[model samples]
Structure formats: structure tokens, C-alpha cells
Target: MLIKGFLDALQPEPILSVSQWADQNRLLDSKSSAMPGKYRTSITPFLKEIMDHLGEYSPVEEVIVMKGAQLGVTEAGINWIGYTIDVSPCPMLFVEPTKEVVELVSKTRIQPMLESSPSLAHKVKPPKSRDSGNTLTKKEFPGGILRLAGANSAAGLRNMPVKRLMLDEVDAYPVDLDTEGNPIDLAKKRTSTFAKRKIFILSTPVTKGLSVIEPLFESTDQRYFFLPCPHCGALQHLKWENLKYQYNKSSKVAKEVYYQCEHCQEGIQESEKTKMLESGVWIPTKPENQNKKRVGYHINSLYSPLGWKSWEDLAIEYEEAIGDVPKMKTFYNTSLGLTYEESGDKPQWEALYDRREDYPRGKIPTDEIAFLTAGVDIQKDRIELEIVGWCEGKVSYSIDYRVLMGFVAGDGSAQVWQKLDAVLNETWIRPDGTQMSIRMMCVDSGNWSSEVYAFCGRYPPSRVVPIKGRDNQITIISAPKAVNVTRKNKSVDGVKVWHVGVSLLKSELYGWLRVNPGDPGYCHFPMYDEAYFKGLTSEELITTKNKNGHTVQRWVKKFTRNEPLDIRNYARAAAHMVGMDSFSPKHWELMRNKRTGAVKNKVKKKSDFWN
Candidate 1:
């Protein structure tokens, strides 16, 4: 009690805005900070009001910043830290998405802030000092402790009591930390100890309805940073829809992109950004914001500091992101400060089953079929495999799906694998008596990897590949990487492990399943049985709310057995191995003629009576 009284007495009586404090003491280090000079609010003048209102004297209890990248959002938070530490000393908790981020901010932002500011540097001594209170994740000051914790660690957010809470990149945080409920709510519990506590939630909005920041923004008075029009002087928020650009041939635009005036329809030159930004004002759209305890602000990349990322830069990024939904979604979230919504079109198993063609299983390839690839799924009791046919436009047909029953011996020899070997090279007769073999086969190396490697090694490298699944958003099938194995002629005969992004492939497969049979990239199945369809559609793509209030898609199996899906993915991966993705019509024509040409030549000649 005495310590609290003494600390309160020691605190500077005069109120100082975070922006003002930053201008006076914040020095941008050339090594780490983007701007290497004394901090100036004039640069990101739009954020100054936010910083000032967040000061100790302000009535605001929470500030939510839903902003685009490079708009000084992080800098604003840093400024608040500077204010809380230097002006009004108090215990603070800074939460990032992960421990890595906590360490990152500590190294890049917090450390630099202390080293650069003389006032802060004096109080928070360098690590070299004997009594140095500063560490990697925690900083100790005279009257307050700045604890840096990751949202991933529930204990970090729950145990500590703090007057100020800063949650950075809240959208990146998981929905639950170690299953202790929402990290935001857990962190909020710590602030109840201090009546004058301040909470700052800042993030680039992620998925619509799934985003953490958007709901908070809606609950508050949604304020937009309004800039005066250079021509008409009409106040307006910068929106992406108002921006205009022209695309030239080659699908790449070298032309300029500019923001058009909504009031006067005039082209607002990028040069006018400074004058406009200086005159910018945040106008709250909701009436509840007048209460002053909670405030929300949203900004976009268009308002990025002059000479930084320009409208033209954003235009180029948009051009590059064409046809790529994820890339484009990232741009919208980070640059436009918007949420992306998935199509929510989940394909039904019965629908796919109903669409199965009359193509007889393992009999003949249709005219649509070009080449065949195989995928092998290893199990303790049986080996399941699928032969998939590929043609122009990524059209796929399931040629055969079978289960070879046998157990692998300790010596790596298995009757199932022998059965696999027979079928792996066996020819499938096309409609015109043409012969086709599995061009490339990818065997799952996840289970019994040693045997899989040994089995794959038995075949030609080009014909057989060991595959494993990867958890990544971008790649469907990555290039071969090293696996756990030892072999002679390691350079030439080493077992290659292909990494397949199962989630990405599943997403694509489901999307294709939604497509009509005649459509491009449509997937076709033979009338094998109901179980096959069940395996194909065993997994459902579930979109759940992440910690950041953003929606992320994950494949959750409805049933235990998803071998059909796994083997299909493997066949698709094998198809990639045989250059199915970018295969030209000419290439397909040559491949289509290969088997028929061989059959024609054999039929034209008579077989010898004696071998």
C-alpha cells in the first residue's frame, strides 16, 4: 500500500499524450526502426488522436484498431508503451499471437524503443547493467512492470495483473490457448484488478464473421478516418471500391492506379495525400461511441504514408493476386482491412455418388481419359490403392480402386505389396483395345515407412515415389525432400519423399466435386460401391472461429476410414509427378496415342508359336 502511494506520488502530474511523449523521447534507431529519427506525429497524423485519447487521463477504457498494414498501427502501440512506461508508470501486459512474436517484438520493437529513448533508457537499464531489469520477454521499470506474453500461453495472460493491456495481431491468436477458453477473455480477467485499466485490441481483420476485431468494432462506435477531398473538401473514408485502375494486355498492368473522388469524381493524386492526411478526422458512425469508454477505428492502405506503398503499388499487388483467392484474400485483409468469406459450398457425398458415370470399373478408359496414375495407401492389414485417369483441363476419372489384403513381414516382404507390384505394372485395356499402365505411383510412407521406402525402391524412380502429407496453405504438392532412410548409391538411389498438402488438395477436390461433370476440372467416379463415395466424402471442411475471430478451414473426418480420400490425393500427387498440371493438349494427344499405337503394331504382326 505504501509502495503504491509512493509510486503514485512519483508519477508525473501533468497529462502527456502518447504521441507527444513519443515526439519528445522516442528516437527511431536506424538499425531496427523503419523511421530512423525523432518520432513525429505529423507523419502518421491520423493516428495521433488515437494515441492522445489512450493516455491515462482519457476516459476511454478500450481502443480497437482494425487497420491495414504500414499505417503506423504497430507504431501507435509502441507509442502507447512509451507513454505508459515514461509518463504514467504502471504495470502493463503486451500480448502477441505466439511466443515467437513476443520474442520478435521484444527484440525488434521494445528493445529498440528503450535503447533509443533517453528517458526510457535511464529507467530500463541495458542488459549489460548488473541490476538490469530488462530481459528477453519482460521489462522492469521504476514503478511498473511490462510483461510480454504470447496468447498461446494461457498462464502468461491469466496469472499477471496489469493496468494496461496491448493485444497485437489479435486475429492471428488461436481461439483457445491450451483449451483454457478464449485468450482475450482470459487476458481481460487480469485487467479487472485496476479500475482505470486500458485495453487495446489491434489487428488486421481476417475472415468475415470469424474475425475477432470486426465484432468488437461493430459493438463500439465504428469510426472511420475521414480525409478532406483535395477538390470538393467533402469528408470521406478511404475505401478500396472507390480506387480505380486499368489493366493492359499480358494480364499485367504497368499503368498508374489512382483513387477517384466520390463527391466530385476527380482523380485524387497521391501527391495530395499529405495535405489530405493532415486534414483527416476520425468520424464515428455509431451513436454509442459518444459514451467515450470504447472506441473503434478502421483504416486502409490507401492512407499509407506518402512515399510509402502507393495506390499504384496496391494496384500491382491486385494484378498479381488475380485468380488466386488466398493471395487476394490476404491482400483484402491486410491492405483493405476487410474480411474474406469462403464460398461455404460443401460438396455432399451422395451428390458425387449420384453423378458417377457408367464407366465400368477397371475395364476401359473413356475417350476423355488420357493417362493413368496410381496412389498407394499402406495399412497394417491391407494396402488400398487407386488408379486415377487424367485428361485435358484437369479432368479426372477413377479407373480403379482396390484393396490388397496381406501383412508386411519383418523382412519387408509382403503378399499385398506383391499383389501391388503385379497390378502396378499391369495394363488397363482402353476402349480401342489400347494398353495403359500406371505412369506414376505414389505410395504412403507415413505408416511402415521402411517397407514403403524398400517397396518404392524396387520400381523405377520415375514410376514410384514415397509421399507424406504436409500442413501448409499454399502448396498442393511440394518437391521431394529427404526422408528417414539409408541406401547404397545414396545420391542416385536415395528414397525421395514428396510432401503433399492434403488440406489444399482436399479443398480443390471438394470444389471440383461441386462442379458439374462436363465442367472443366470436374472429377468423375465409377459405379464401384457406396463405400467408395463414403471414403471420398468422409471428411468435411469445417470453418471454425480462430482466436483472432477469423475463420479458418480445416478438414475434419466424419468417419474413421478416409483411405479413399488419401489414395485419391496420392493419385493426384502422382498426376503432378507426370506433369498433369501444365500438360498441353498436344502432350495429351501424344500420351493418348501411345497405347493405341503399340496395340496397333502388335495386332498387325503375328505371334511366334514357339517362344
Candidate 2:
């Protein structure tokens, strides 16, 4: 044993890169990784250089990454933490957005990481009841300690001095922690004591102006991964615009999904992605800042490896997210790794009136009409409803609007509801002689709550949706909630009401109303009178201070008759509930075929009757 120990001591210690160290020692836990076993950097070759730059030997002090989801960036961070523990031990701090997220990552990610690799497990001991060194938020090794923190906690940011700092999902962090100022600024102060400190900031960006990572990313030498096209050998980075797809007519999947080379316009299949990635290289866009001791990297989900998020799935997701603002925002931040820009200005109603189409008010215009939805607005003396035809890409046509004048509340409300039932049940004729029925109808419960609920409850929940509008809701439409109503001194059960985000819907509608006729999400209107246009443009969005003294946007009526705007948002809510938000091109094609086939069969039946 002494002879062996002497021989081992005589051998020189080996220097290892972070990627090499992770490949040799790290094991991906099944609990966290899709493929659980020995970790291999070759699977995602784009991450190798990023991981190596984070190694102890590299001179780079700070690394900023603005990345999309499912790209193994977070796993690279875990590898860095594991490498520090197993190889170059130092005081390290990892910060998530909140305490709850820190707890979740510690339990699901950090703990499993330690247990998966023997080298990491040996250095960072498991927590026990009596062990203070190894706990949920902290881990101690031979030469250093690892601490987990939350950006929301001021105490966590000020707890200790750390040489290695990692801020994950920094965009989700609050602007100020307990009014102590920026959490990132506070966390950076902890590393001032160490000259060779390393800082890594990573996030999927949020809004353009409100993003925390975009400005930080702009400060460093920005690096992007470029791959050579297999067909034409042209080197270029993958872009959302370059990805093309054609949906299958019979199936709900893409018939063809390919990347068009930016240089040669050659088609590249997904199977060639592996070789392209293996040969990919990162080039700094700001080469002048290469020696600044800081580096930044940006990549989107298009670079995700094969079997992880395919190009087809991204195309379909983008297609479905085209018209909905919230869904588009999520796709941009999570799939494109970019911030979403919001347009809050209202569109002028005069433009809409002048560009109105000449289609008939009560008939479907063309095969473009995939379905129909109606929105009902209840007033004291009458009920106003608008029927809207929805097409692919959420292009909508204002088909018809009717007012039933009567007592819509208290005594004679039953007759008004009966009139509404007839309008809802009417079949509208398409230009091709195909018949279309109202798929769904949303009745506003804001004016006469009990009466609206009673009218809506008469039909199936799918046919008639009762909705109450709420300001500043996070989502456009929420799931329906069952409420009890009292009738004749007895409580009735099972009336579902959905809460609608009027503010968000109005924002989306006004944006679409501004689009030209040929563009996606453009609104087409029939020949309505001047008063109709006035009511449609009745409310204008105004910025004002709320009770908390914070700036907020509110819709205030410029005209007394705002039923057109109210009923339009209700129609949008009906469309949203009936899957308009997620319908792809194939879905529209199927509906079109169904209507055409039905019309042909009806003609054949009439011909056979004459024969």
C-alpha cells in the first residue's frame, strides 16, 4: 500500500475542462433528465464551448445567456456547480426567482444531481437530521461551500461572500427586493471580495422594455451559434423566418417542415441537424469586446437537438399563436428567446368604417368562415347581440347585429330571452349554399346577472357561455366556475360563468382592427350605419392612476352607446372558448371540406328528388 501510494503521488495531476469534467464524472438523474445516464456533451455540442468558458482555468469572469427553453442551458449551469464542487472548490451561490422555486430546484434538481454522480456525491454529503453542513439551501465540501438563494429574499442576497454566482431566470426576478433595490445588484455586491469571481446570468427574456437580461446581454461580446447548411454548405444561424412548413390536408400535422438556407435557398431536413450541430461554431458579433473579461450568448429553440423539440412542433406552435397576444408572447419568450413588444394605442373607428366590406350582413361570405360565434349585451330596455364569423388566423367577419327591444330584466325578461334563443338557433347560409350555425354564444352577466345566467343555463354549456368581464385579468378567458342562483325562494345549482379579461381582449381587438384587410387577424365588417361605427369606437383607452397611485390603463366611454364594443369582446370570448386560439391551418381546411361536402350532398339529394 505504501509503494502504491508513493507511485500515485509521483504521477502529475491532470487539468480538465468543464465539459471534459462533466462528461467524465456527471450522471444525469432520471428524475430531471429525459435520458438518464452518464452525461455526454456531444448530444448538445453547442453547449460545450459555453461550459468550457465557465471552467476554473478560463479567464472569462462573467457569462450572460439569453436562451429559449429545453436547450440544456440549465443543465450546463448544474454541471458548472458540480464541477466546482468536485474539481475547483469555491464559495458559490445559485439564485432563482423566488424562495419557492429555490426549494423546488433544490429538491428536484440539486439533490438528484449530487446523488447521481459519485464524484459530486462524495464531495457534497447528503443532508441528515444532525448535519448543519449539508442542508436544503447549503452544501459544504472539503475546500468550499455551495449556497442556494432566491432573488425575492433580501437576506439571501446578503447572506455570504461568494466567488461563483449564478442567477437563473433573472427576468422573473423582481425589480426591487423589499425596496432594497435590484436583486442582481445586491447579489453582485457579495462577489466584490473575490478578484477572480465568476458570474453567470441566464434567462428567457420577457417584455422588451421590462426585460432584465436584454440590457445585460448587450454589454458583453454577443456570441451566436452558426451551422453550415448540409445542402449548400452555407454557414448561417437558424432563424424563425427561415423555417417553413406546409400542413397536411387530411391530417393535423405538417406535411413538410424544412429549413430554407438563407444563402442558397436550399431545403434542409431535420435529420441533418445532428451533423450540422456537431460542426457548428460560435462567432462573436461584437468582436471588439472579446478581451473584456465578459461574454454573452443568445440562442433560440430552433437549435434544440433532435428528439428534444422538433422544427415541426415549433412551426405549428407559431401558427396557432399568431392571433392571440398572450400566446404569442409566450412563444416569443420561450421559443424565440426574444422579448414581446406590446402596442397599447387604440385604433381609430373612422378607418374601420371607411374600409368596411360589401358582404351581406346576415350571410357567411366565403369558405373562409370556419365557424360562427355570437356575443350578447343586455341593457335595461333591450338586448343587443352581434354574430361574428371566425376564419383561420382569427380573421373575423362581423356578420350581423340585432337589437330586441323589450324589458330584459324583472317582469317581461322571458320574452326577450325567447327572442334571443331564436336568433341563436338560426342557420345562416354561406356563399356556396352551405349552412352554418352558431357554434358558441357568450352572454354578458354584468348588466342583469341573474337573468343572463338563467337564459344561458337553458342551453348546454358548450352552446351558450355565460361570461362576466373583469378588468386587468392575466388571461383572456378563464375556466368556467359553477355558481348557485336563487329562484322563487329556492337556490338553483349548476350555472357556470366564465370570467373574461376585458382589458386584454380590448387590447388585442384594437390591434387587429388596425391591420389592413389582407393581413392576418384583420377585421372585416359589413355595411353598418354611422351609429354602429360610433358605438364600436365608443370607448377609448386612457392612462390613469389607480388606488395604489400606480399608473394603469382603463377604457372609458366617449359615447353612451358602447354596446358594439362590449358585444364584440364577448364575441371574442366565445371564439376563444371554442378553440379559435389554438386552431391550425389543417383544422381550418377540415372545416372547409366538411362544409363543401355537405353542400354537394344537399344538391345531390335535391337532384335525386327531381329524378
Candidate 3:
């Protein structure tokens, strides 16, 4: 026994790549994985090369993968961690978007993976009551410690040096952590100390100009998996355009689905996918960068394993997402692993003016109008307001645009404010003879904020609300912040002020403006003059470098007057705050019933008139 032990110690450590190591020892816990058994690279053969590059023997410094959801990339990342702990035994760090997510992943995924694998379980002990090193966020093994951190926390990213760094869902990470800088840059600094370090970056990219992963992926060789056609043997990467399906027109369900080969024009069935995936090869689009230290791979849900996310499923999802911006964005980001490109260029004002519908300006044109909202823009000399009618599917109609020409400063502000109140309180009739009043009003407080707050505070908080525009906000409207209002230079009662993400709303509005009528998120206009169209399209989205030397998108005015755009943004915010964003079909039906019921009550029958 002593001789055998000595011989084992003398024998060189077995050389195994990350894939080989995972296939030999990694076990997927039943609690975490759908397929809870031994890990097999064959199941997701496309990931075998990606994992092998992360092995301890590889000289590649960085491996970046821009991928869609449920492509087994996360499991592949866990496999690398397992191999590092058992074989390489070096300090490693895993950064997630938030600390809460890190904790959740640690308890749900990392802990289960370690506890289920015998080789890993023997090395990394489970967290104990007294063991600080072996906890949810930190795991200690023979020669290395695994630290899980959040990209939002700068301290967590900078506190330690790590030989291997893995950033999962990097696009979800905060742009700047505690104002220190970009989280990716901060985390990358942690691996600079190691001579031969491995860095893995993975994410489903969010947007084209703003995505962190897309740019990183572009910097590498940009490898894509190419599979040979089952019939023609011609090799090509899968594309959404080549995917064809036959669906029932009435039911909108897929009847038949197949991938049309680019070369042979033959339809490949789903059954042939497994063999094709197994025989696939990764070819770099930019072959000159093949020798570069950083390598990148991009794969969409089209290549998702046989049992997961079939082509038929994607076809049906794409059909359902048509004409809807948010759903289509999800289909592009989460399914195709592609950035949803938003056209930032200025939409044509002439086209919008020419296409104005021949409808009355003051009344709702259609019974589809669910509710009404008003956006008030305060200027030094005048107040501009637009009454907008909103319906399901984010279809909006411009009901009225009024320019209250009165001194909106000091004592004269009261006249314009009172005029705005009169307009807001006014009832507009729909074509069905049902009356509708402004459900919500968002008044701009950026200019003459105190006066705006005082004016908005006059009404109930539900009706009129003050809003401030923020360029950096992620959502269109966040929770309102209470602010103390001042009257006569003395503090009055506090009022709720909502922060509007103007940039996001503007992007949405621009996209909506480009869409034709009858499409989801389409914007309809009355017979307004050319000036209104010009004001609506006054600003152009431009990409410029910030003071921090990072590229940032900004909306710059091409014309002097942009109150139309600002007012529309506020109206969008008001709709969001009123829960229109989450309103169900039942809510819309209830609103319609209320409007129709009120109309019915106004009319008296011939028998009731005598009584």
C-alpha cells in the first residue's frame, strides 16, 4: 500500500481538458438541472470547443461568448469552475449582475454542483455554521478559493486578485458601480496580476450601441458554428431567414417546420440536427484575429440541443412577436442572441405630416381608445400641452395640441396653469358618443419646478403628477420620489415626483413613429400642420463620447422647439405610472364598459321620459 501510494505521488498529474474533466467527473444535480445525471459534452457538442479553450493548458487569455438563453452555456461555465477547483486549484472569481443573483446562484447552482460531484465534493466542503471560508459566496478547497461577487459592488470586484474571472450575463451589469467605473473594466483588473489567466465573458446582448458583450465579442475572432447540410454536405451557419415553417393561418400554430439549406435548398428535419451539431466546426469570420489572445464565439437558440428549443418553437414565437416591439425585442435578444437595433436617426417629419389622418383634433376617433392622458411642457414664455388617447397594444392617437400663450413665469403663470387645468378637466367624446376625461396628467417640473409642483399638487395625486426627466434611467418610469414643495418661499407639503427615462421613451417613440398605422405601438396623428410634425421629429439621436471616454447615446435637437417630443415623453410616463403597462385585457374591457355604461345612462328611453 505504501509503495502504491508513493508511485501515485510520483506519477505526473493526468492531462485533461475542461471538457474531458467535466465528462469524467462532473455530475448535474437533480435539483438544479433538467437532465440530472452525468455531464456529457456530446449533448451540447458546440460547447466542447468553448470549454476546452478554458482548460488550464490553453494559452488563450480570454474567451467571450455572446449567446442566447438555455443554450447550456451556464452549465458549461459551471463545468469550468468545477475543473478549476479540482484540477487547477487557483483563485477564481465569478461576477453576476447583482449580489442577490450571486447569492441565489451560489445556493441553487454552485452548491448543488459541488455537493453532487464526488471529486469536487471531496475537495470543496459544504458550508458549515462555523466555517467562514466555506459559505454561499465563498468556497475553499485544497489550494484555491472561489469567490462569487456582484458586478454592482465595486469593492467585491476589486478586493481580491484572481487567476480566473467569469462574468455571466455581463449585459445586465450596471454601467458604473458606485461611480467607480464600468464593472467589466473593474473586474478585468483583478486578473491582471496573474501571468496566465483565463477570463470568460458571456451574455445575451441587450442593445446594439449600448451592449457590453456585443462589443467585446466583436473584438475577438467572432467564431460562429458552421454545420454541414445533411443533404448537400455544404457547410453554413444557421440563420433565422433560412428557417421556414408552415403554420395554420386561423390557429396561428406551426404545422410543419424545417431548416432550408442555403446551398442545396433542401429542408432539414429536426431529427437530423443532432448529427449535424456533432459534426459542426467553429469557423472564425475574422481569421486574422485567430492568433489573438482573446477569442469569441456567438451561437443562437437555433443551435440549442435537440431536446431543447426546437426550430418549430422559435417559428411560433417569432410569429407571435410580430409587430410588437417589446416581444420582438425579447425574441431577438433571448432567442436569436442578436441585439435589437433601434433606429436612432431622425424620422422624416414630412412623411408624418403628409400621412396625418383626416380626423377631428379634439375628439377620440375610434372606440378602441381605452383612456386619455395629458403631457404638459412648461416653458419660460408659454406652456405647451398635448392630450393623447391611448389604447391596448400601445397604440396612441393625438387628440389635441394646445399652445397656451401666456406668461408662465411668476404671477402670470397662474393664468396658463389655470388654462392647463381647464384643458385637463375637459371631457372629450369618442365616436361611440362615450365621454372620456384625462385619466392622468404628467407635468414637466424640470423648468419652473416649484411652480409646476405647486400646480400639480392642487389636484389629487392620481390625476396630475409632476415628472423630471433623467437621461440615465433604465426604465421609462421608476417609482415616484417625494419632494417638499415651496409656496411663497416657504416649504409646503411634499409631493410625489416621478423620474422619467427620457432617452428610453424617445427611442421607443421614434420606433413607433416609423411604424405604419394598425401596427402595434403605432402613433396616429390628427390633421395637424407641418409645424407639429417638425416639432415631434425635432431631435436626432447621436452617439458621442462622454467625459469618461466611453461612448454614450444622446438626443440632440436639430430644431429649436422640441416641446412636442418632451410632452409625448411625459404622456408615455403618465400611462406607465397609471399601470397601463401591466393592464390586462379584462382591465381594458372594464374601461370600455364603464365608458359605454355612462353613455347609456345619459340617454333616456321614450317610456322613462314621460315619468
Candidate 4:
């Protein structure tokens, strides 16, 4: 009588279709059958609707379900398995990520559902006796056997021709399996021969990038369900961002916040939302028979009767404890199958994309380019130089490579300086017989400052620039004031070279240079060097302030180390060429007019001051 009453209440009205009526009936009673001499286990309306769909045995070859946690998705799967076993009795395989999870499911969830479900309990025979150590598989009256396998082991999934395959938490499966291959691919092979085979892939969404489960969800044959709004009568999907809340300060309580209708722009409270959802219907949005074997459903925690209190209570607790970001996002979007708008750290890869189109290998164009800069990354025994030649606003060519065996001590310091001098002189000459000197050659003065200084002194004045790398900002230290030394009837040349900070150069480059996608001019000597990029925190960079209370910006290095070669060299070279120095024409003229050769040693005198 109880089962009959529930069934009669569940029957569709004349105007409603079978699926529509089933949805209504399941929502009202929440139970389908009653068992004699056993405690009645109430079914959730959501699970009952799924069970009803299974009973129909539609031609749908697959069912995809997106569900909130603790909505008994696993339980529904088990019940469906039991139903299939009792009605049809075919080979079935249940695949999970690990053996431990399989064991837990088999012992706890599966066993209890079979024991408690009155419909399943009455149909299956009692357990048979076997050896104490080894347990025999339990068989219900129907001859179907349900086997459990772990995806982690390749040997476990071999040679299994199954009619139904239930893949739980497919997203969490390891990308590669020991011997069988990817767990998903291996499991699909098990059902290759069976034309009427049923496969169900279900999981909570993870990262947005493509993964194994994404292919199934992307298929057009799959179904996506949307609930209609009561006030505006618009079909809509639930999103975490739209949720609003009202708080009571004295009681420290929070209630379900209202959301403005996307269509009507009117506030819809939880009560109105419930009414609208109750009247809403879920139907197949795809065409009649294009990849028609698949079905997908996204379930939220709000749909579960028992889950309501927890959801409401958590919203209140989270608002008070840690703020709304995690609780609202994780619980609503991940735990529940709701959409969320993400706002946080932007990927550095996006910046890299802007220069992508400008980096293709092609013939170097001969034109009057405005800026020619070289960034040198220095090492103890070797140095790398990236020469960027820009024509108009586009990058013409970038030569990124290293020069080895330039060690100062190994090859006498003079010899090393001589080689660098040769390279610089070569860069200044144009292929068409004109002198195309680089506006700036940023030499790295980080580790070997003395050697760099020695080399700078030998070059023409105003030609070589000194650069310092600190934090993110590169500051060029200005040339010291030239002091007159006329004592003891002797004259000495003071240090007159300009010192440019790399941070200053980096600022200019970031501001003026537009690195389009594939820009060759945006070159790093050591490509994708993490040491220059990952050290500093974003918050530290953003919150940094100068002495005058303005935001102080610095370029993040692409590599890690006390002295980053690529960034340091690039900054120094660019700064020197951009004329970011205070120097007179006489300085360059005086140094250029001097004879170029190795310096000769002279006897020391009291008046020979090392100024």
C-alpha cells in the first residue's frame, strides 16, 4: 500500500510527459518502495529521478553527471549497478583511482546500500560460506557479477569485456598508468566490442586546461541542464558570483542572500529560487541523433534535502571566519556544480604571448633602424650576448648566443678585455660599409666589477656604460664630479666613466617597447631562465613604495641567482645606448684620440696619486 501510494503520487498527469512526471513525483515523495520487516531508507529526490531514468532504459549509451560532494552520486551509481544486475545481469567493471578507495567503496558504501535497499535486499540470496581467509563473491538471485578494479595497476584492467563501466572521479586519475596506458583509455578499451555498452564518466571540474574527461563533456551529444528563473522566466545556470548575503551582527548569523535576475534585474531570494527550480524542467538540448549515446547532468548541493542546513551554516561560518572567497568558491563551484568567475594572479605566459608574432626566423631587413641594443649575460668563464636590432617599431633581428673561454684570470685580464673589445668593434661595423655602432652595449659589471672597470677605462669615453642590478629597478650611478688634481707639479685622470643603473633602463624598455606576439627583439640569452623570473612575490612588487610615496616598479628577472646574467646584461646595454648618462663630447674625444694598445708599466712616485 505504501509503495502503491508513492507510485500513484509519482505517476505523471495527462499533460506531463513520462520524464517530466517522473521528475515531479520524485520531488514530492522522495521514496519509491517500502520493504517488509526492514527500516525504510528514504531516497533523495535527485537520486530517485536518476533511478527513474534508468528504469526507462533509453537508447542513451552514456550518462555524464556533474555533482556536488555528498549528494550520494556514488550511491546512485551503486543502485544503478544493482538495478542493471537484477534486471539484465551482464559483466560490469567499476574503476576508481586507487585500490584503497575501491576497498572503501566496496566495504562501506556498496555493502550498506545492498543491505539497506529493500528492493535489492529481497532479490539477493544470503552470502555463501567459503574459506575463512578468502571470501566468495556475493551473488544476488540474478547471475550478474560486479567486479571492482583499481586504475593505478595496469594488470588489474586487462582482458575485461564488460557491458557497463562506471568510472568514478575520472579527473583525479593519474595522467599515465604503469603498463596499461592512461586509465580512461584502458577502461574504454574494455567496452570496445559491445555496441549497446553503457559507460558513465562522472567528476567534479578541476583546472580549466584540457584533461582526459574534457573530451566527453565537450561533445555535442552530451546534455547540459539549466534551471529557469521564477520571476523572469529565463533559463539560467547557477553561479557562485551571483550569490548575495545579509548578516546579523548580534547573532553572528548569515542567511541565504538574494540574486538579481539576469533577465529582469529584480532581486530573487532563496524562497523564490526554490519555487522557480521546482517548476523548471531538464530536457535534452542536443539534436535527435548526433553522437546521441551520451547524456550529461550537473548536480548542485542545494538539490539535496540533507545538504541544505550544511550549506547555509557554512555560508554563515565562512563569512565570519576567513571571508567569502574560499567558502563561496570552493563549496559552491567545486563541491556544488555551480559556475564561478575567477579573479587572481594573471599568468606570465600572457606577457610572453604579446611578443610571439615578432619572433619568426626570416631574412634580416636592411633599413635605417632607430635602436640597436645588446644585453650581455655574464658568467665566470663564459659570456652570452643578445644583439637586438630594431627597425622603426618592429624588431629586425635578435642574435642570442654565448661566447666561451672569456675568463679574465685564465686568459690574462688584458687578453680577455682585448677579445671583448674586438667583439664590440665588430658589432659597430655595418655590412654596407657604414659604421653601425650599437647605441648601447650593456656589459655586465656584476661579479667581475674590477675587470669590467679596467675594460671600460680602455674604451673611448662615453662609449662604455657601467650598470648595477638591484631588486627589480636598475639605477645608473651617475659619473662622479671631476676634481682638479694639480699638486706636486703632476696631473692624474680621475674616474670619468658614467655608471647607469639597470633598473632605470628596464623601466624605459617596458614603457617604450611594444613587444608584439613573436617579437624577436625581446630575446633572453638563456631562454626561459627561471632564476630571473620566480623569486619575488607579486604583493611585494605591487606594495613597494619609493621615498616620495609613489609606486616603485622593477622588472622581475627571468632567472634565479645573486647575479642574473641575461637581465643584467640586457639592462646595462640598453641604458648605455639610450643616452641615459651625463657626459661631455670632450670626454669621448679625449679617450678616442688616445693610442689603443696595452698599457706600459711606470715607476711609482710619491706624487703619482691613485685618484
TM-score of each: 0.71, 0.67, 0.80, 0.47
What residue pairs are clashing in model 2? none
Ordering by TM-score: 3, 1, 2, 4
Q: List the residue pairs that clash in candidate 1.
A: 171-548, 174-547, 175-547, 210-549, 210-550, 211-549, 212-548, 212-549
Report the number of the highest-lDDT candidate.
Answer: 3
CA shift at 67, candidate 2, in angstroms?
1.4
- For candidate 3, give the lDDT: 0.84
On the 0 to 100 scale, the lDDT of residue 415 in model 3 is 75
RMSD of each: 9.2, 9.3, 7.0, 22.3
Tell me the spans in candidate 4 whose CA falls farther than 4 Å from its real position.
Answer: 1-56, 122-128, 131-141, 232-234, 247-252, 272-277, 284-290, 306-329, 338-611
Give lDDT tens digits, candidate 2, residues 405-489: 8898766567877798788658888887778888888999887777777667666777887899976454678767888776656
lDDT of 4 by residue, 493-571 (tens): 3424344444333333332333443442333222333433332112111224444332334344343442333444364
Tens digits of per-residue lDDT, candidate 3, 1-611, equal 99999999999987799999999999988899999999999999999989998997788889999999999998899999999998898999999988888998999899998889999887876577466468878999888999999988888998889999999999888776788999999999999999999999999887667678888888888999999999999999999999988877447689679999999899999899999999999999998777657899999999988889989899988987676555577788899999877556889999998889999889789999888888999888888999998888789999999999887766545677668867865887778888888888899999888778777766667788899998655567767888886555555355789899787678788889988777878999999988888889899877777666766667899988898999998998888877876676789777766753221111111221111
C-alpha lDDT of residue 195 in model 4? 77
* Candidate 1 global TM-score: 0.71
The whole-model lDDT of each prediction reads: 0.79, 0.83, 0.84, 0.50
Looking at model 4, residue 370 earns an lDDT score of 35
Better of 3 and 4 by lDDT: 3
lDDT string, candidate 1, 250-359, tens digits: 54554666789899999888888999999999899997556678888888898998778888888877766544344566688888988765443456778777778897
